[model samples]
Target chain A: MNATEPKPTEEILESLADAKSVFIVGCSGCPVGCDVGGEKWVDEMTAAVRGAGKDVTGSALIELLCNKALVGIKLGRIVEQVTAAEAVLVGSCGVGVQAVGNMVARRTVPALNTICLGDYQGLWPGEERCGECGECVLAYTGGLCPITLCAKSLVNGQCGGTGDNGECEVSPDHPCGWKKIYDRLKELGRIDDMRRMIDPRDARKRAIPDAIRRTTRYALEVSEQEDPAPASEE
Target chain B: MSKLQQQLEAGKFVVTGEIGPPKGTNIEPVLHEAEEYLKDNVAAVNVTDIQTAVMRLGSMALCHMLIDRGIEPVFQMVCRDRNRLALQSDLLSAAALGIENVLALTGDHVVMGDHVQATPVFDLDSVGLLAAISNLEAGTDMGLDIKGNPNKLDGVPKFFKGCCTTPCSPTPEAQMIKLEKKVASGAQFVQTQAVYDPGAFENFMKMIEHIKVPVLVGIVLLKSAGMGKYMNRSVPGVQVPDQIIQRLTDAPKEDRAKVSVEIAAEIIRQVRPICQGAHLMTLGWDHCVPGIIKQANLT
Candidate 1:
């Protein structure tokens, strides 16, 4: 599930300032779990928008706003209110906001900023995300993924640039990822696990772009059994 | 073996110097500084690669130039601007140019440099780069041939491979862990980030005693009191103690260089008992290397 955080209040209000009426769309999936978007957030946002002196066209909490078909059906149920609004305020992750934009002709504005799940976690529990690098070294790192947590994504170990305060050299705000991994491994009594030398990541393994497609082994087996192609001669 | 490697192997407390290639084509001044001050004073002079990720003349080119001047150059290679193919090719190029010493670094982030918008290419971290160098030494490359075998090099070149560490990092355990990995990956020696506190450096040296690679503690000359304070605030893993900052502040403007050399020599004297050597990074003040070496009695 994608993580999300609320955008600044002033930014959201300013984007919707030109509209006479605003409808709010909240996701009940990941954002709801994150406590930034849900039925409660939708109600709060509607009240806030109304307080800003705009007509409230109503709000709906759609399940899995990332699913276009589901979002379309949910918006269809409130067609009258949706059509009456000049702009839709989406209180979900970037994917959910884009889904609402695709489904409606009205100006869709996002109310939340989609933070990189890789860089953030202590802010919310269980916020770690898999980068799908195709090769996992979680065991060696005591379940901490340096590829995602480290600012430079250094797979071997920490760079020498770690700050004196255990902050990343890139910025004082970011904690050193290897330090966390070191602490975790120490707690697990697996300090020697870090000694295992990991090879450089194969670029081919992560060459998959926006979409990853997989051919099922069942289909491949069935096809091979049904029609075997002639072998080519060298 | 390179002179630095030979000296380390002989149990000599060797000292290395450093020089940053100029931002433009006019490299005479820096090269002259190296020849004038560092040529006979230090074992080898390090030519930084886009030091701090700020773009400048390439390290390889400057390193080749150093060879012509009869100066031993430690070609500092960072994995921030090249992919695996380019890195391997450059390693071969460096060898072809008679560059014996190579320092592998993950490098500082690009955002810290002048060109904030430039992209950083950490295709291989320091450990991986070291492994690659080892592979090259073994007469093979880090690639598979058409027959799915390690590609063979026509005439493999060897180097005195070195890596860097921050002895004063707040995460000392983590830094040690990484250093252990670097040594495991084939790091022959280490030239560390600037170290000011000899006590911290001693502690770090004791912690890394298991790793047999020679470690050269780094010392960057403090040009002024303001630079010391700025380093404390901005330079990661480098903590210039308040007393040293006060020393720089108390020094008269004309005597700042003398005081800076004294501070550097003092740190070297303190750490010389515990470590293999010292790496003097004078920034633009290359003329101070001889004075520091003399004061530290490294000769």
Candidate 2:
């Protein structure tokens, strides 16, 4: 799932200072595992916003805050509470905040900086899994991503700035992306494959892709497909 | 016919040279180098188009200059700078200007160049471009224009188009698949990335044994052990064997250039029979060109 973390309460307060009343929103799936968005976290946030001298008009632990339909149905019931609040505090990823904003047509303030698609180690952010750049070149360059991991996103070849010990020159703590790719290709008995270059991605090929977008290749059915509605009476 | 094309047709061991366009309007640097290549009996000189993403004089201009001087020029076209229309226009102009032997390439990404801020307009990849070039030759368009001017153009360039290949890829099958696509798209020949390991290149060549197109192995001169290591660590597709790195390291700086020439000559001798030709890339060390050709005795 798209991983996220709770913004520092102080940071969220900066955007909420002008609002006398606020509504809290949180995600049920990823943010729950991430510890930033859950029933307990929503209560905590309500208390904090209340402590900041703002009234907690209403709040909900959204099943998936990024889901427009679920958000519409849930927020539709809380129309009076939503209108009473000056703004919303979304305790999920940026996508969730944007999704909430898109659904309610109200100001949605993100309480978390959406990080990479993550493997949540704990409630706090730890690791990034996928970059979601539309193209997945993981098979060619080991299981890691040079696009996000490497400072220079060098695809065709590695920059000549590598230190001999196989550490990234830009970040000493991080393992060099190209070195990792080289070693992985070597281990896979396919070192010669590094010679070929990945073509530049067509930025227009994939639009702001939703759950079940179809492309020339396989359809990426990220969400469950629903059966077609019975044809309308002629 | 272009000298490179003629030599390839004759089944001769071809030797092509490289000359980057001068960054400024200085025409002398390019002309002087072209004259040197001609004197060295270089079959053709491949003019780079903003190689390494660095801005330079257009390859087409230098090519025209060489053509006027009665020299064969292989025009290098990269997809990084131009969209399909501009690319197709240049292709037609290259043929109309008597420039044959075009090399289609997906140039270095813009971030690697001085003009990092410039937007990259890679409307097509190398394989896509080869297909476009073939379509252009077939009296059709790249299908980029939607208005359906599907009628044939008044003039079309019959280019002896070639494309670049990475012979020593980590995934040989993937490389083969793309190479097959390039050939299918009407690429007449292919010049590979600089090869250092004979065994690796041999395996790649073996996989590509069925293809009838000529494969000219790229040979970039290695000046020192440090450079070799740098390329090994950073340069994609190009790797220097540890032994060669050790060989250069064992030599003093004064003799490193000599050792480099000798090593290149040896590689040329070894791969001369296996491949169609040797594409000698004199990466700013043009003086060593004569010594390499003479030592290798490549025609």
Candidate 3:
């Protein structure tokens, strides 16, 4: 997640506005492990809402909503607990929230404004390490994700705002991502990779649209069962 | 009695302040700032060790510098970069320097620092560190053996050990258990994390009334509304009420500092009865602490 991006303040405020009984759901996926929205976050948000003079019905943390089996088990219990609540506040990433919405009744409200898929790393409180662009270019940049680093997210060239200190004009504390990519390349003795011009990123491929389906072996089994057999005619 | 013990026994409204040392060898500014607090006659001046996971001058060395300047220093020992041997050695060094007061803490993780490559040595957690301190005070090392034939300096070095507790913990039961462990490990005084809401602190204090040690409520001067929100989101067990944030937001740019001082002073004024005293974490704004103390009528 973008640590600098304003936290789920607005989402939390909006979630508790007209709701008395609230159920908080935490995500145990990417952002959660990095300290954004996990079991600790769920407890913190619950206390915050409760301190605001509202009754929190109950709270549950799902391990990974992307996993069908785990989601099925956890979401079943979550739906039951939140059944009596007026609203549900999910503290997961955007994808996790969409998955939960698919399984649950259409009343749960998302309390977290899911930012980017990344790690927050810096001396100061707010610094994100990764920005999950669908394309992977770590092979050229010495394992450093340049898509997240470059100020303009430029894949080919450096931004015009790079200063002597490698900091972007937009923010002095933040290093120009492209400059870091160049430095890392030089350090790894692979400066020749910098000469390779990159093309524009395909937005369609990068866009993580909601409700994605995975064609597992179970799908193949279902399709085989759907086919008419000679034994069925007998 | 030690100076801190004497001060506490006299029923004095103890005033302790924090000093964030600089990173480089240019220690003039740090010493100057520390002297400023010392000149104010604060009961004790705490020299922080690796605050916010950023490396700086060692707390033991800085505390020694303060002691040499005739100022009582409370050396903060965090279990982040040092192993048990180093921790024990540092504690022994502090005792050797006659620096009695210590604040034990489980330091921030390496991921939170600018130097992520640096290895984090969490040989012993805060609880274990506290136990080590207690053992040191009992004239034994971590191996439970007497040091130098057990007759060194008439007895074991007595330390006015302190540990931190967060009043804004999600569960008071767990927080109390941790606090009790600290107390059981020989914490003479408990310094809480930044406390913004009096109601929350009151509830936490009520839950831990059985612990007999004095609880020093941490009073952090709120810098800005954004800062309040940042702390609320990033740091666990630190909840800044929206009203406080709004108060900061409404203040003019130049008056923000004064407004923060007033807010901290007001919190201290209200919480003095419940807590022994306030541990002021000025967050590099030490000059305003005197003003806060004055405004709060804390003698």
TM-score of model 2 vs. true structure: 0.61
State how far residue A13 of model 2 sits from its true place (Å): 52
Tens digits of per-residue lDDT for model 3, B120-152: 665565667788888777777654234435332
TM-score (C-alpha) between model 3 and the true structure: 0.56
For candidate 1, report its TM-score. 0.73
lDDT of 1 by residue, B99-211 (tens): 99999999888988899888778889999999999999999999999999999999999999999999898878778888888888889999999999999999999999999
Q: Rank the candidates by TM-score, best first.
A: 1, 2, 3
Q: How well is each residue in A1-234 modelled by candidate 2, as lDDT tens digits? A: 554556677767875666788988878867776577788888899889999888999998878765667777898998888878877777765445545655663456667654533222222222333343444444345434556555455454353334446655444566656676666556545555455556645444223343223432113222223365789999
CA lDDT of B228 in candidate 2? 96
Tell me the TM-score of each prediction against the true structure: 0.73, 0.61, 0.56
Off by over 4 Å in 1: A1-126, A209-234
Candidate 2 per-residue C-alpha lDDT over B1-299 given as tens digits, one digit per residue, 9 for 90 to 100: 67788889999888888888998998896688678755457888899999988999999999999888877889999888988789989998988889988999877767668998998776676777887888888898755446666647777778888988877655455457667767877889888888888778888888899988998989999988999988877665677899999999999889999999999999988887789988888787878888998999864
- Predicted candidate 2: what Cα RMSD to the true structure? 17.2
Best by lDDT: 1
What's the lDDT for candidate 1? Answer: 0.82
Residues A122-215 of candidate 1: C-alpha lDDT, one tens digit per residue:
2222335444454445535655657767888888788977776778888898888888777776765667767778889876545532221232
**Model 3 CAPRI rating:** incorrect
Which consecutive 10 residues in model 2 chain A have the weakest lDDT in total? A117-126
Error of 1 at A188 (Å): 2.5
On the 0 to 100 scale, the lDDT of residue A98 in model 1 is 49
